[model samples]
Target: MTPATSNGWLLETRGLTKRFGGLVAVDGLPLAVRPGEVRGLIGPNGSGKTTTVNLLSGLYRADAGEIELRGERIDRLRPHEVSARGVARTFQTPKVFGNMTVLENVLLPALAALDRGGHRPRSEILEHARGLLEVVTLDRQRHALAKELSGGQSMLLQIARGLMVRPIHLFLMDEPFAGVHPTIKDIIMETILRMNRAEGVTFLIVSHEMATLRRLCERVSVMHEGKLIAEGSFEEIANHAVVLEAYLGR
Candidate 1:
């Protein structure tokens, strides 16, 4: 268990650092996200937002710092282990199994969990998977091969798959709205909000869409050169001088 002070945070990191041959991709960073909060992480390209997500998701191991989820250290776990711990994430680019049907792609995670001791009935799991497809507006495409879908549709598939991982504690969404049509973007945003409000799911969303962040996030954190520069409500961070300088320059 973490110290009492950290109990309030669903996810927390301290002095988080990572480097690729001295590039210092993530440098001495600290982050905290409260339970059920939709928090936005924004920065210019190469600001370490995705790198941070990768570390937290265990795709890339950290060189320094610790990651705690509900007070247990998870930074050392493997990717599958992290997922088993109830951390799920979407990537900047949609990743799907081209050969698999859309419904099969969504079913993969839950089926994997069962292999690892999850006891949910197969019938119930299948029904839940179909329901998630409906939420993402992809129910009609359930029979199509994943590779046959458009880029936007592939993104929706990725989200449904991510949500299929049961017992999700925190969801790390990276650039979910990028290149998506406005209508599809609204659907994605609504799905996120619905899950957050109805399921009390926590999210750490990394996005560049300022307007969407303003609408979906209770608070936003700004990063520059691998370090956090500002954090506050959208209105507060929007007016922050340091944040402006980082994005617009002097």
Candidate 2:
């Protein structure tokens, strides 16, 4: 099946496929993400969730498939090119500049946006960066070095960096709640919901936390062995026999 898009969806994939030598990591996957939806992608280990994210973010090229964003073809684009086209992503592990200050870590992406021919002034960039730090509740630690932050703080810093890019329409996040404290997790969850509601940022979140997914997502897709097996509301999927079998290794 080919992932089809319509007026409402922000992204679409048609027969997306990828392989490592003889092993197929993603097999003819078809998926679509609607604008303003917190879509969840969940599956057991080795289910190809990470691989699908890599392919969507342009970190890996599909062997045979098509990808589209907002009605334009994007499968042929490079990672930076995809970023330029209003797509942003975060990794399983947070990536922050250890040597840079907290504010500086977030400011770099704004500079990159300027470098890409955006006409915003330096003052605008700085102001926006500071606002992001405040949004992530790191304003007081603006001058602190990234290395000084806790694990959860590092995760917030990573997200702040991604938003510096102008006109970001889609965000692909992998395991944003992996090792953080419960309070920090609440903050992360709140931030995501705020962005989605206030900024209209669409998200494709890959996480193992089913409870979080239930709270955060309106729809969830289940992948097993590189193929999407079931998709629906959380309530429906939780009771699905196929989902049960896949999780239990039946």
Q: Per-residue lDDT for 1-250 in model 1, tens only? A: 1123356988999999999996998998899988888999999999999999999999999999999988889999999899988888999999999999999999998898899888999999999999999999999989999999988788889889988877887899999999999889999899999999888878899999989888999899999999998999988988999988999995
The best candidate by lDDT is: 1
Residue 245's lDDT in candidate 1 = 90
Lowest-sum lDDT 10-residue window in model 1:
1-10
How do the residues 1-250 of candidate 2 rate in per-residue lDDT, one tens digit apiece?
Answer: 1122565568988899999999898999989888788999999999999999999989999999999898788999988888887788888888888999999888887687678787889998899888888888889999999999999999888888877766878888888899988988898898889888888888899999999988999999999888988999988998999999999966
Q: In model 2, where do residues sit more than 4 Å from their true spots?
A: 1-6
In order, candidate lDDTs are 0.90, 0.87
Backbone clashes in each candidate structure, one number apiece? 0, 0
- Which 10 successive residues of model 2 have the least lDDT summed? 1-10
Check candidate 2 and list the clashing pairs: none
lDDT of model 2 at residue 92? Answer: 87
